[model samples]
Target: MSTASAHAPAASVAPPPPGPRTEPLLGNMRALRRAPLDYFLAQVREHGDVVRFWLGPKPVTLVAHPDGVRHVLQDNVRNYNKQTRGFAVVRELLGQGLLTSEGDFWLRQRRLAQPAFHRQRLASFASTMVEAAEELATRLDARCAPGAAFDVAEEFNHLTLSVTSRTLFGSDIGASVSRDIGEALARVQAFANARLTQLLPLPRALPLPSHLRMRRDLDMLDRVVRELIERRRADTGTHHDLLAMLMEARDEDTQERMSDTQLRDEVMTLMVAGHETTASALSWTMVLLSRHPDVRRRLETELAQVLQGRSPTVEDLPKLALTRRIIDESMRLFPPAWISSRAALQDDVIGGYHIPAGSFVLVSPWVTHRHPRLWENPEGFDPDRFLPELERERSRFTYFPFGGGPRQCIGNQFSLMEMVLVLATLVSRLRLDLAPGHPFVPAPAITLRPRPGVWMTASRPRAATPASGTGQ
Candidate 1:
């Protein structure tokens, strides 16, 4: 032995990161199933940044601090990939799409899909969004009387799915086809969410009732994709939709176009994520506004000044400051994609803890957005904090609802523009208020949508003057 260690005890490795007490083969699964968002927040508050969790025999290390999140998501992102069980569940629904695929394949697909969401594409999409909102407002007027209770969440979901159908497939997609896609996706999402919280989840190969139902829905989604492909192949005219972009894009290296299988996978991914997330985000924004009439009033005033008795355009987005801030604040409080995870490719250190190779690393916007050390009055709804002057001073990774870095959501700008136009058009023509005594607890599934949905009363607002959107 060396002189320094001749009489000393052999060096010992550090103990594992702290976590809630657990039982053999069943650690923390019950807690996670009962209320995952609350459970995650509690874990971070009690155990510090690097909290270890066990679901069954596997250990999951949660990196809750902003620096660690940035490290895994941005700085050394290649060292981690979406190979965790969480993403595996998403992959089961979305196939080998950009959200689940990794390495060279993901890079190639991302490049192929980039131009579909460019500025020009978004301008056309914006027109589709505003037109859809105006049509929805007209429908609501025909059916919803004063004080009539309606599920605004469901309405927003239907509207977003319609817009997505028109923007993704084509403007000619019929209402019946949109309804079929919506019904199938709803069942598939429920099945995926159920799989996420199961402790001893049975194999899908087994003939379980839920598994059989999910397979039917998956098959339906496949048929829809096939139909879209055949239709696009037959048509020779130029189009402004995602399916056309993917079909037309050629690889720089090989000059080869995407195959039918690749198109199917990307379409499935976009159909699920592009609409559901936007709808959830918009519903949450409406709920926040319902609780804060003053914020709603200010938003109306801004819309009046910017729009001036007309629907908002892509060019008017810059002038809608308060409208954008309200959306930002709502997302901070209730992000649609609340939690996401990745698998470590090798050993690494995060938040001063040893994260071993093969460790499952988790990050949650729900927790970090309310981190006391990073946010002031983090639970309170305050839109002013998102003003450019204040937002510039905050940490980059501190409030990542759409994630960050290379793998950040590819359709973020498209989603934001759609949301702004939709809000401007609807809030000026219709008013939605939460039904009295309705609870607002979020159902943390594949998306963080409200549980039992956001029930509200809808009515058209009568403007006192042509220039004012604030009158009811």
Candidate 2:
């Protein structure tokens, strides 16, 4: 047996991952644009975990298995870079911030931003999240009649925008400011998505309508960010907000600080990343909770027992296991950062398939989270799957809502803490039910947003006491 194994023929080279026929030059671009989420889901389901496709002349590989995802995101992360078309579009808005930067520069920025998101620092921001949720509850109470429908998506967007603004910049972003930023981000995201999907996008310098508008929106974002930075600089007292921390941070090796341009990029990155994604997650959670009454009941019970009608603090987080699980499951189902792409910096093998250099590697949480082999009842909504024991049995890459490895989201802890506090505060006080006849559709853009926005009816919780006041 040993002699036979030693002389065994070499393993056969596996053929490339299967894919559907593509038009010569168009190359599946139409299918991608028609329904990106559905298209990707079908690719993985029909073609197995590692599927290959083309975008015109460019090669795109969809990695749907956890092991393969680990290979790209963690094990050989250096061989993959964020120089993909998707990130290029993001950079048009974010500049050379941590989200878009690569190499040694990204390392320096990550280190500088790391301390501000330390557990201790995030603990202090709980009050801000609770306060924002309380204000939202009060506003919803006044605007939404009992059993009458309103846009929960809009409300969550406003609430999270408020929370992120106060926590990151130490200033209240009022309705007007939030509206300005929101509109600008929407425009930028739309343009970016168009550019990402287009086989050959128009040049930005062409003065085309979309390009012109994107530039204008980008300028608006810059103005707001610079204004915030200027305001922080003019203030006399030291603040503990993220902006202050970033401003004071210095490279231990070089003793250099981030310039104003760098500051603007980082601040804008925080605002966009911190606000929009959390709001999308919360909105989806609310929708899921309303649809799954049993889960919602359990969540309400957990909130009541842990919060006791008081605001949730950072200390209360671990105890609110169900709340965290609900958020996790919601993100699993409808992750805001649903799909992320990386460009291969060098040729490598992932899951036994050859990946050529400069190829686009797609790691979609949307597809992997529902992979049949990894998840029992893959389409079902069950938060208990995230119970510690069960979660420990799963692969780390199976449920990466905040992504995995070093390039993972920087403010993940901050987002989770904020969601927990805000969800606890609001759910304890109000019962949100999806409005009758309102369709639930996921809009896959740069971030996942509800297409027409989630419409819901807000009412006082049946078991809760009358509100004496809002927030702690």
Candidate 3:
């Protein structure tokens, strides 16, 4: 499964028959630019689950079938490497953190980080989630101001950012810093995907405008992370935070704790992935709720009936089944991690299509989750689609917001708890309704964000009863 074997010069790693080609060098770039998702979907319609094309000059393969996705993510994982488009920028900001590092380095980092997210341990973080949600509720309650409208997306982004900052570094990300980081992150992601440099292959040190801005953004984040690390190092008292747990973690084999640089990378990795994606998910949830009144009302009714009137805890999650269903549906419509890309290390056949070594393979949750053949009313938002009874009849890859297999988001459980608690707490207290005729379009960035922001109105629920809300 080694890359050497996959790309062995002596071996014929290319598919038995390579994918069809278009006119000379134009490739499939123009078609993709016109309508990327539809273009890929059309390929699946014509050529079946596996389709190969060029993104400008680079060769890429798109897989749509469940087995095809599983083969790339699990069985033949070692025959693939992270693709350049996404990882290159991620590596620039995070360095050798779990997301970008490969081989033993990533393995060691994952081992050290996994304990903090263990089932028993994550229970302690529920209170933290509730506390963050309470603050969010308080902010929104104060903002209601009798018939005033607010950007639900912005509000949720702030809420998730608060949770992420407090949970990861035990810091309150102020408005200015949050706005700065958010804007910078957006710019960096946009610039990376623009493929401006694919035509030039500029070095990291190049002094281009985009590069300079990205560097400045990285410097700002680095400064903040280093300061957090220094403060944590200075504290001698025992703290039950992720940072403390990471600091205490040791490699079983090497018995070496993480160094400051390693700590910085890990912290930044969590901050970036933790906040941005969660925020987008929450935002989209609100948008979906606005669009689907019945679902939102049922969610509120469940919160009222189940909790009476209290924040959720770990034990309460199973009972909050409907709320979880709403969140799941939102994710299916707009998964935070929209697309995952990897380069084939060895030529492999997926869905009867031959993929050559070094070719980039894209398994997009956005594309597959909404595939016409795989989903009923694929473009519609419906929570019942995730009901265990119904899901049992569907293909595994038909719904993978957090992905599947080992490479799935390690923070999946934690994130789910966070989202459920936040939603339950907020919806139990406030009624969110979408602005009439407001256009809510999907903007597929690092996460699927609402293009115009989720605009909605918030009103308090008319009830006063003692109810405990816990994470199940």
Candidate 4:
């Protein structure tokens, strides 16, 4: 036996984690459905980091502490698999793509896709990102006249969709196609989130109204993706986009290429993941910036100093520290992947709480990022908290907006770079102010999106303006 295995400590059994007051069988289902974010926050505050509740007969545990999160995501990662309720909904849409696959298949896909996201390769896409942002800025300039109200969330959705299409597939989805794909993706995610909250979800084949709608939306998306894949395959020219690279990727051991179905699944996964999450992040960031003008001033000042009225390049990223921090802080307050779940493949113990085999373990970046014990002013919008010095004092898992461990987001760097460039380019030209009476609130579906959308007015920044005095 290996020395590590020989000396490993034996597992010890412990009682389930403490939970809120519950009724027989039903448990916290009602509360979880009504307001999941508040429910999770309250549970962690009252029941400690590890909290347990029942979804009917099934047991669900929420792990909110950094150490416990580490134990589940890293230390004992092998014992946990993505076979939980949350992933089941994702699997229905994503199939065996990297986001929902497991075991060796996931590893091979990860390896094959890793090279496409290399720093050098991603650097080449910086211009594409900036160009997309510029195109949006020009359109917004024309449509959003001074003091004119518009839905920033909707605009961001379009901007991110265009960027993702160009970067991922080397094609523009255009205005009409972008809108169609955006609407279809929204319906699919809504259906999936509904399934996630149900104690006994109806099967997809049941032909319920919701199920039928989901089927239609899924079919619409599949058709669009399949068409894109077919066009890529038929093209003769060499293309550098992610789709082309993925099409050409071959396994080292077997020397095999991906099948058409595999390519379609991956394209769909990247299309959804690459755009939707980034759009959500940008939408929230714009809302926060509008509400916190002082933070906006700082961000604008940094952009001025770094870019001097020119478009930002990949080389300018290091100098745009505050821009990156704003995105980081925005994600902390409203993570794109707000919640994650893993089912235990073997019995385990985390933070002295027993996790039985087949038990579902939940981790919420929304809760952990705002944990009272972890942050001094957990709910405040303070980008400086992510500055290097303060960031080092916290656990790595404490602010996992992109998740952690081996399965951490493959597009993390790509997303970060994209956000920075887009924010810098747009904020340099126009300042987005919240529209009157918009009533913006977070709708934590599959992704944490803004409910009713974030309505805001865009106008050119006033030259040599004083700080707004809302400094962090």
C-alpha lDDT values of all predictions: 0.84, 0.84, 0.77, 0.86
Single out the weakest 10-residue window by summed lDDT for candidate 3. 1-10
How many residue pairs clash in each candidate at the backbone level?
0, 0, 11, 0
Residue 409, model 4: lDDT of 92
Candidate 1 positional error at 160, Å: 1.0
Global CA lDDT computed for model 1: 0.84
Residue range 280-320, candidate 1, lDDT tens digits? 99999999988898787777777767777888888988877
Q: lDDT for model 3, on a 0 to 1 scale?
A: 0.77
Instruction: In angstroms, give how far residue 61 of model 3 lies from its true place.
Output: 0.7
Worst 10 residues of 2 by lDDT: 1-10
Return the top candidate by TM-score.
4
List the candidates' TM-scores in order.
Answer: 0.94, 0.94, 0.90, 0.95
Better of 3 and 4 by lDDT: 4
Off by over 4 Å in 1: 1-15, 462-472
Query: In angstroms, how far off is 116's CA in candidate 2?
Result: 0.8
Off by over 4 Å in 4: 1-12, 143-147, 464-472
The sequence of per-residue lDDT tens digits that candidate 2 reaches over residues 1-472 is 0101224332244345578789989998899888989899888878788889889988899998888888889878888999988898889888889889999999999998888888898898888888889998897777557667899898887888888788888878777988898888877877887788788888899988878888888888888889888888889997988889999999999999888999998888888888899999999999888889887777777776767768888789878888888889999999999999999887666666667778999999999998888999988999889888898999789889888999999889999988888888888888888988888789888899998899999887778332322111
Query: Against the correct fold, how does model 1 do in TM-score?
Result: 0.94
RMSD of each: 4.8, 4.3, 4.2, 3.3
